[model samples]
Target chain A: MSISLPKAFNEFDEARQKGFIDVKELKEKGKNIVGTYCVFTPWEIILAADAIPISLCAMSDEPIPEAEKHLPRNLCPLIKSSYGFAITDTCPYFYFSDLIVGETTCDGKKKMYEYMNDIKPVHVMQLPQTTIGDDSYNLWRNEMVVLKERIEKEFNVEITDENLKQAIKARNEERRMLKKFYELGTLCPPPITGLEILKVLYGATFKTDKNEQNQTIDNMIKSVMEEYNNGVRKVSEDAPRILITGCPTGGATEKVIQIIEENGGAVVCFENCTGVKGNDTLVNEDIDPIDALTDKYLNVACSCISPNDNRIELLDRLVDEYKVDGVVDIVLQACHTYNVETYRIKKFLNENKNIPYMSIETDYSKSDIGQLQTRISAFIEML
Target chain B: MSISLPKAFNEFDEARQKGFIDVKELKEKGKNIVGTYCVFTPWEIILAADAIPISLCAMSDEPIPEAEKHLPRNLCPLIKSSYGFAITDTCPYFYFSDLIVGETTCDGKKKMYEYMNDIKPVHVMQLPQTTIGDDSYNLWRNEMVVLKERIEKEFNVEITDENLKQAIKARNEERRMLKKFYELGTLCPPPITGLEILKVLYGATFKTDKNEQNQTIDNMIKSVMEEYNNGVRKVSEDAPRILITGCPTGGATEKVIQIIEENGGAVVCFENCTGVKGNDTLVNEDIDPIDALTDKYLNVACSCISPNDNRIELLDRLVDEYKVDGVVDIVLQACHTYNVETYRIKKFLNENKNIPYMSIETDYSKSDIGQLQTRISAFIEML
Candidate 1:
């Protein structure tokens, strides 16, 4: 489902740019394949299991008439869309479907694991819905090891420690490169727009070759920074300082940034699960690489899955570091993690710091543009 | 604690209004009330049997250091204020040495009940959080009856079936008056400002006497309807229609309405657990009155307890009746219920209807108004 739909929705620009490994061709490449679902963690290692490809379900337009037929309409849309895609054989390669991973951020997603397990082979992991401490991260690290083991056994493959270390190295290298891309944002003119950074980040995830992803990011970052250094697109210093964090705002990202800038605010800093949560941190290699990788992943764990994920702290830090006047927690429809975090962020800001924090959760659609503008205008005027 | 706290913080609106029920004068009043606790159901019959005053723990500005110590820093301020009033003994009427009552809602509130029961004598009733079907309604109805019997036995008072019916009538009448107030919103000019309605509705919950509440509401509703009929606040016809729902948006309600109007959108309808979830459908007198009342309460059950209690049909009905082009599901801080419901509402709107719905969660303060306004404006534009 992940393979075909990313193509159908044109979700992966990097993958297409790099070159294609068609599902049929990829299938011809190996057997005893294994599959798993993922959101935050890298798919590179899962593929390196020398098993089948592990796909990240980034949401695509596909029908799930069968899953939707039995499930209540109120269930999360991603689950519905995945089930819809699965049943239709959109990704016919998913037939083996060794395992499915799920998290518990909101009730709907919590139920998604339980609901899907009834229909097919499944593996469920309870992700932390709140950012607490190091507890959730450590727990998830242990669970990931177990999940990896289960995948190895299912595929009848030997997942050697050395191979696992290599996978960790590859993922860390990707993170470093992505961080370099984001660092360009610090430039006076921000050589790269937020969208440019987002595109390269998302592109890296779908592309299998780690070295190619690093090169693309390094090149883009260099090019953009050079342009900004040469006095290209200039960013005003007196613009309204804004902090952007939480889940995907979809296409609304540009609209949000535009609205903020128009209303005397500039999105100077952002902490989106997609944009920065997994970008800045690197896996430690000195210790047991597995535990080191786990520790690193835990330290920089993104997604709504981590219980210890304190979005308020992220916003607070951004506000302090960037001199942000306001913080906006933009959430996607059917994303439970951010919805739950929205309240905590608002409370912490209102009670402790008196910082203005606003939450906006929506489905990515072009129609909501005007409503979004008025709200932004009013919020800015009040500020 | 309730009595002592009100005295401490010195907010006497409750004490003065409950009619001179002073802690110092308790001995003179000749009531052997050792302690007091607030209740929703007829648990009072049980407290009375046990020779205790189940004081409806009305909102009080009392200081409760103990409660503040136990609760999370991010819990609802309103709830914290209530607890504060309890411990300070300024509202020293509550027989804290005897009992208290609590219902399940958000994780914070749920944990609050767990803490209260362990630290103090507490009577807990699992309140229905959602009203979806007749079976669930009947289940709550049965629970209410069992509760009444238990109360009678505990208090050692012969609460005859007749007394139970009267209590039921009192609550039903309270609801009916509240419904009448809500109906006034249907008028062309909406008899009163949205803020006025919210103030009155939340204010009335602390009042135990049915007659006084009904009288106040009846007058307010009448005046509002009269003003609407007299064409007091009608607006232009091109305004975009909006249906606002979910948990309370607090002060954001007015800002939302103002932004919508300014952006050529009209907030024609609103349905919130705090505002309308308690304004249940009319009771059927022909049926067992107590049973009927229970069902009614469960029918409009607030989505503050669990996501399992969602009424998508009710939401659909609102969209149809109100001619809504968009929806905004506001999730208040520490409110897990509305946060969960926000996801469901978003998914439902996306797949089933064309209406654009945006979810916003708040901590009930003055910040984030700009972000909310932006989201609202974009939503209206889409519509």
Candidate 2:
């Protein structure tokens, strides 16, 4: 039985449809808008500074032609699209932001920030690539302090420790709610579709009110659990449950999910950058707010980090938790970190996990949609 | 006037010609042989344990075919060639090594090391991508300690703090001599060729005795200084002086340097991984030897590091000091970090430094030799 998405998801769709309306309204109320590209950006600090944080990582294939003029065509499509939106004046979020935050996540995006500076005021956070070292924590903690100071100076607002504590509480609540939302995917014949869940998760990045998002997620979880208890399934019980991992697939680029679902594969969980992995861990509430934020953000493992054992561990845990039948590793073309890592991920899954794996290397174009569909269909058939 | 290389350089060449003979002799004498890939590997710790540290980064076009069997054909040729040497049993250095050390400098090499463990005992050091972080220092320091212990255990010897300090002293002496050797290249008409300097630097990686290497460099510096006093010129005084920087170009890969020289561009300095920059800084003896080694190794400025400002600073200083008219940034194909970084390097040189810059992306094969020569010729003519 195919179950319908809860009404709360419709509310999220409406908010996304009215693009940048909330941000524009907030801007009119004199709120500082901070644009960020990665989840590594500390959203709690922006909230503490009484500034609005919006993810500026674009998901459109349209603006790529414009970005190709500035960047090489062989770069990750996500970067190209995001940059394309910036240069073409297509992303309202980019235009509305008072300041844009960038981090040294990867070489392409790191240097791309220099070009981004030409378009907008950019604050770069020098991120350490290894998490095991003491220097990484200290440096990131100092960076968080610097970010706090910069945000305060830029917005002319003092972000006191008390304010940071309150922000941490609010953000941790969101994380808790998100965790509940994803846990519902663990149910057999998962009541909610991956695309529906992805929409809600991606929409949260730009959602203005944390409390409202928490309420919506709470309602959706309740409704999904109710449906699951009623034995209502959005996907067939026998459908191949796949765990999608590698590279962030956000915005309208849900073609991978759409193709998989249409071809008898139910995406039970996404292990990508923009997935639940981004917010699965909570900030230590007992520690200094800055250190808490530093520890939490540093733990979000990206392929950019050396010996990213955390990412692998998370993937392994999710596979077992979600009852995944197969793994679909989708990497955006030219994303060297993820592309090269596919070899190891495939080997690990096949050898240790005893799970079937398929790798799909694609770009932000519909040209490969047919090919992707065929490959994913074949994979699901095997499952 | 045409100038021949000094007699000391010839002697250094003779030492290299007897390839792995010293290592074999040392092995017979019960000396432990350790292999490393990047400069970030703590040679001091290995030296402290009385092991012969040899750089096993290959620079051949031959073994790539063998490596392609294990790795993808489109991966970094440097990694493929290195791994190829291992699988094919062509590199005597790799065969002779009791332990081969690999660092997480790039995704290609990090994953490749896992496969390399099948051929030889591989020890992977998880290198932090950003040096500015406290975590990077702590992790690297811990890694150094671990390496020291591993070497000590492997060799059945104790690596005390005193041994580390003495090793640091000898390594610093080598650094001091290398500094003097490169300073000769800054002369208006450099007496020593770039190829000649690169040979000496590369040869030092496998040279068993630090004192012997230091003595050789000292004699070479004296000979070069004597040539400068006699007004000897290796290339035309009007030749466009160029600085080459990017990935490590070791082994037999002198195509880039040869192309530059043959195209009327005199390469005066290299800001690459295998160049003087890797050893330009000395460990601070005042601090704990481990911390000092940590600080020095963390400062190598590999492209793997995030927020690589040190690399830019090094390039800027070298451009001005070397009196370089042009900069050639050559990256092995699929080496993503340096490839993406070329844009920023180009922009910085053209806008800030007012120097002509050209980026060449090629592989180990000689197929691109003609194209490289044409481009270098054009760049030199423009200069």
Candidate 3:
């Protein structure tokens, strides 16, 4: 059963054009809404607090004049995008209801939040920059506890263990299906089409309905298996397998995969927030769901969203699991946190794993496809 | 007339072996010492405080093992150096200082202050990352006032306006003479040699007696003028005039200047905390000296210290005053603050003026000669 993506909430472009769940309607229905920059780690719980529909306000849209009011022009594009949304009447349908939240992914984001909150009061917390280390993990956990209390104080909504558990259950189901999608990609010659995987993955996170998303993912998985069984997919036995690391993991990531494929390579696995995180699994279903969800989300930590911990292990696991022959660390300029950490990853891989690694730097205008193509060709040839 | 740099402190290698100031002696002498890293705008005033010595703890020394205990490996080197001195007996003089002051130069330095304050009590203040607007300048001014009070409270010393004026007078003389030396470098077939000027510049800063240092500078200037009048100097007329900008205008800066000169370019002027700032005239000598110092220092800010309101103007002035042909922005890899501001300077120069600019990123390693040479040669050829 191949389920179709719901027309209401599809791709980011479509959502941007069609407008997200209407703020006015939610206001009329007495549903409070809060806006955020990125879909953060503790997002499901934030959304589940009956605090209105939590929407991602990616700060990379057209420049907003109002953002320049609060932030310097050199600030990260994501910050500018958020400011643009905040000032513009574009999201009049989305309730600009309660408080906004900012997470520490990079210094730019962190500084932007500081400047933003100074202008307009927003509840802010510093997330762990890395996903590794018990101290870092606990710092985030403690922050979440404080954050939960702050949210409760602001919205006057009680977020009990039961409500959080329900949210985690939904998120975990989405994660499982997303994981299945990733496994399909790891299959020799990749049974599922990259296009189908992109749509299914995108829908898993952006879809308003959890059950429908799960259904869509299941159908996509079944169709991929059927296609594999029918032997209709193009299989490249000699193609070098690779894993793409860093941000811009949506359609931007596909470009990287396409480049690799064009250079006689195949992207077998992706460990990015926007890539396969929708398929992340639940951690210890028998345990407290909040902890489980935190663990699961933490385990699927996005390299682009925050500084990744143990990228060496992540890459090693991907290499072993997906039979990867090379790794491409695609980072962006102004995204210094990832850029610095990637060098360490490169050093580690070079010293320990004998893996061929190349780094690609992208800017807001990732329109330099020729440079990227040349780099990809060179990287593939080296591999 | 030339002041000989203490043989021990003549070169970085010798200084490393001779060791830094004795922090233990500083504590015993009852001299209120303020530990500072990089160059803060108000540090001159802090040093001017009665019986207080502002020990600039630029992170240019040996690998800071002690600082590495508390700070992450990738912290701003200056902060690490300060922390290293504070915890270790290596630089016992600066280590046992009465207080440590750190500013919000970058995220790492900001975090290091937090970490230090949390672990060991220290004074920390948020400084504006950029120096474009009045609010930013006023914030620094107010910070200077608060810092003044805080220093008084900690050291039990009255840091009067007179003392600050005296300090400024002495510092300005030092700066004026240094600028004069730089101006002489701009003379076609420069009258004074870079090595000789560097020795005197590095020596004059650490000299305890202010009047004697001025006398030495006067003598050096006279010698250079005499040499030029007689046409005895052999300076390169075809050399492109270069301006050095960055921190710790010491042996490393001198080395860079030598490299540029050897590569057929001349370091005609330097816009750095230690190089250009000592000459910033006291705005109101009759008024409150501390306030005058604050206003004056803030007026001519160094990118390595604080953001200045007139950075582009500063560049233009250097271009006009010293007749510089190019700007060489030298900053270390982890120097986030200087790196960002240098980029700003580069962009500003590119837009406002046709002066060629080159940015050199180093890790304070002496072995970076190859990288420095390549960039300098290319830049000189372009000029």
Candidate 1 structure quality by residue, lDDT tens digits, B198-217: 55554454343458667756
Per-residue alpha-carbon lDDT of candidate 2 for residues B1-383, written as tens digits (9 for 90 to 100): 22245555665655554558888898899888898888888888988887888888888889988787667666788898989999999888888899998887776787678679878888887676677656567778888887788787777999999999998898888888887887778988888788888878776776777777786677667766776687866778998898988888755458889888888778888888777568667898878999998888888866767657788889889999999899988888877678767877888899999999988888888888888888888889999
Off by over 4 Å in 2: A1-17, A65-72, A87-89, A114-128, A131-146, A149-165, A217-234, A282-295, B1-17, B62-74, B84-90, B100-162, B179-184, B187-189, B214-234, B279-295
For residues A1-383, write the lDDT of model 2, one tens digit per residue: 22245557767656554658888898899989999999899989999998888888888789999987777676788888989999999888888999999998776787678678888999988776668757678778888998999999999999998999998899889889988887777878888888887777777777888897887788777777777787766788898888989888766568999999988888889887667777788888898999899998888868777657888899889989999999988888777667667777888899989999988888888899888888889889999
lDDT of each: 0.54, 0.82, 0.60
Query: Considering every candidate listed, which one attains the maximal TM-score?
Result: 2
lDDT of 2 at A96: 92
Model 2 alpha-carbon miss at residue B121, Å: 5.9
Deviation of model 1 at B17, angstroms: 18
TM-score of each prediction: 0.50, 0.86, 0.55
Question: Could you tell me the TM-score of chain B in model 1?
Answer: 0.71
- Native contacts present in each candidate (fraction): 0.01, 0.24, 0.01
Q: Sorted on lDDT, highest at the top, how do the candidates line up?
A: 2, 3, 1
Model 3 error, position B301 (Å): 16
> At residue B71, what lDDT does model 3 achieve?
50
Docking category for candidate 1?
Answer: incorrect
Please give, as one word, the docking class of candidate 2: acceptable
For model 3, residues A1-383, the per-residue Cα lDDT tens digits are: 54333332244235333335545555577666565655454766676687544545452445445665544444445555555555564445223546677665445554455445533456655454435445445555655776778778877889988777777666667777778767877887776444445545544444455576577567766765776687866647677777777654543445666677777877777765556443444555577756665566555555432334444566667777777788887665445445545645777677777788887766444577788899899888877
